[model samples]
Target: MSPLNSALFKNTTNDNIVHPDYFVISGFAGIPQTKYYYVFLCFVYALTIIGNTFVMFMIYIDHCLHSPKYIVVFNLALSDLCGSTALVPLVIDTFLFKSHLMSFHACLTSMFFVLGFITVQSFSLAALSYDRCVAICFPLRFNDIVTNKSMSFIIAILWIIAALAFLVAVIYINKLSFCRSNVINSYFCDHGPLHLLACNDNTPSTVMNWACQVVIFWLPVIFIVSSYICITRALLKIAAASERLKAMKTCTSHLILVAVFYLPLCVSFALGGALHMNARIINMSLASVMPQMLNPFIYSLKTDEFRESIKKLYRRKKMHITGRNT
Candidate 1:
């Protein structure tokens, strides 16, 4: 062992706060053919990167997609890209390559980015819901209420709040003294698993766990559901059935995105201990990654604006290529 590792393991201080130099990430241990799972994650990560980048590129090149709703969609795609990058690559490294050892600060860094981007992803969905709600419920005032500037401000606030919240949780994890086993059971440096390894009192970490659940999961879900309720009422108030259908049609992409993101998570949380440990891990991992991979496709295929923007971009590219060849 190196000198730093020696010092860390010795716990020579009078306070008895033992800080280990590294942690062993025992991800999917004892599971059969875990390599196959890692390969699947590699595919998911690749698709997530390409799909989200394409969505963002479409939004950027086409000025018609510069609306408030597209702003929210862009934010969601950005978060999906980031969240998948934070998680999938590291997971592949740890499990596929058998690089299970993670340094103290590295673990904290991973936890912060993973959780922060995920929280942003959740809030971005809610932001999209709000955009849809405003468009359907207040059609005349949608321009004034949900401008690009206002949408940008909301996204900025969500990113700031998520960063600060996860930063605090990571700071709390840093304060913990890991005197016992440093083996994390999850695929990544998860907050709860890391904090549970601490030898000292973990009340704050425990509290933060529940707080994260409420803030990251429950609150956004409630907001999205409530927004949909408002949207439904607004649609009902429309006199013509065709108008109601048209208004509701605008929400299909966002609703699908919401369902793709939240339903697996809801099932995972609901099943809790009823699931086998490995099964739960698989469910949670899928929940984390599948939405990121699917969000761009859902929006691009379902949203008419995105399809139009894509077609515009394609025609522009074709014209440019023909001009260059001539």
Candidate 2:
């Protein structure tokens, strides 16, 4: 069988479709080795949905959470909601319906939105790290520096940059003509999967994609790491044990989020060009899913305030339900 035919059409033996030419060079990897893997994905999806939704609600209903810091958190939670929801449902559809085929437009739209939100989320986290550094290291100036006006500006800038980054990608994609092999290997349409369909001459899009990765992913990650390092060092120098502990808690949570998010994202986007088509798909899925699956839990579990907020929200809900019944 021809490679194009083999990739686009389902193989009876593999029971999965192959990567289309518009995407990357390889096919997907890492189907759940056991039933447990499927269960785990479902669990991640469930928690991601619930956790992000609840976080949104907390920020929405609580007037107190309207501060600059919480605004950043709200955006992060929103991104996580969209990012995970965009991919997981499609993945579930694949598993449940055996319907792995995504329409061409659906594939394109999904790829664009997923990449866009992930980029925006990275920027938001970077902003959050800066906000923490300022709050902790310069407590007196935190309010003045991180005002609502400035916060809105920062969020707007981040979204603009993210939109431009993805928009450039969309334009690049327009240049590539998909001659054959439109089947996407994985459950969702990522840039890698879309690139495989391009004719052999996919240089412009590939280069542009790399450029976006560097600017959109690594640049913010570097700043986030460096800012946190400075924040941690400053906290250590302080004399009060209690104060130091508080700083440590905040800094640690932000750093953990930065690492979890950037590491996999960098890995996946980094491998976008270099790896073979099949291996790239595997790497892409790994990179895309892990950060998203872990994001909601990371933020909720790591922060005491967020956890308490979630608890209170749930308790209120429970009481409301009981009252309705009574």
Per-candidate TM equals 0.95, 0.78
Instruction: Pick out the ten consecutive residues of candidate 2 with the lowest summed lDDT.
Output: 17-26
Model 2, position 243, has a per-residue lDDT of 81
- Local accuracy of candidate 1 as per-residue lDDT tens digits, 171-278: 777767787677898889999778888888889988988898888999999999999999988887899999889888999998899999899889988988898878
Query: Candidate 1: deviation at residue 301, Å?
Result: 0.6
Model 2 agreement with the true structure over 29-99: per-residue lDDT tens digits: 34444245456668877877787787778788877678887888888888888887787676666655556
Report the number of backbone clashes for model 2: 20
> Among these predicted structures, which one has the highest lDDT?
1
How many clashes (backbone N, Cα, C below 3 Å) per candidate? 0, 20
* lDDT of candidate 2 at residue 66, scale 0 to 100: 80
